[model samples]
Target: MSSSRILLASRCATEDEISELVFKLQALLPERRRQHLRRVSRDEVLEEVCSYIRKLHKQVDDTSERISQLLASADLDADVLRSLLQQ
Candidate 1:
């Protein structure tokens, strides 16, 4: 049940690729052995999760920058808002 002891050879995968690979791999397992399979599959799972997390982090950063850009372009500064409200 515990998967921490699992170790796997290092491999490279992009997040989308990892997701597809995990889905395909898990789907190939028998229903009765999926639990054990996960344990046995720890190496691949860990690799995929790591890749996905990194991709998510990059997306989060990019989204934050985009929001800042939008706010700047929209002239949403507090001082500008205050001036507009006064008029």
Candidate 2:
């Protein structure tokens, strides 16, 4: 399915709706290739993407905390400000 249709399918889509969409999309693929699509359902794909997003957000939060700690310990002189900019 196109990204537009996928976006429309987001969040509010019922499990039956997603299954129907996936079924239609699968029909366009060659018989042997259909198995690959079946390996991950639409819900599975959504969950995986959400999991990755959470991981990335956590990394951002951790990095920001470390930077705050670095800034807190540093002297607020002109040279130190320049060093922070370089970082």
Candidate 3:
């Protein structure tokens, strides 16, 4: 399918918030119908894939940062508990 069509399918998907456009498109049509679908250039597909990867990477980085902060807080709490026990 064309890049624009895939992107639109992603936006239009109502069954799952995290559904991939390609999967949605595949589920929408039979193989025969799919064969007639317009094909997107490799460059356009590559650009879309790269953009998605970057978005996923950012999400992972943000989650990692939040986990680090939680761990640091837990360490501080542990220290406070240790001091109280010593007293």
Which residue pairs clash in candidate 3?
A: none
* Distance from true location, Cα of 11 in model 1, Å: 27
After superposition, which runs of candidate 3 have C-alpha atoms over 4 Å from their true positions?
1-38, 76-87
Which residue pairs clash within candidate 2? none
Model 1 TM-score? 0.42
Q: lDDT winner between 1 and 3, please give it.
A: 1
Tell me the TM-score of model 2: 0.50
Instruction: Write model 1 residue lDDT over 1-87, tens digit each, in one string.
Output: 234323221345655676677767665555654455564454765565566567779999999898677767785779976775589
lDDT of 1 at 76: 75
Cα lDDT computed for each candidate against the true fold: 0.63, 0.71, 0.61
Question: Residues 1-87, candidate 2, lDDT per residue (tens digit)?
Answer: 888768777857866887787676566555655555577777654555455567779999999999889888977998878877899
Superposed Cα deviation of residue 42, candidate 1 (Å): 1.1
* Full-model lDDT, candidate 3: 0.61
As for candidate 1, its clashing pairs are none
Cα-based TM-score, every candidate: 0.42, 0.50, 0.42
The candidates, ranked best first by lDDT, are 2, 1, 3
Best by TM-score: 2
| Lowest-sum lDDT 10-residue window in model 3 | 18-27
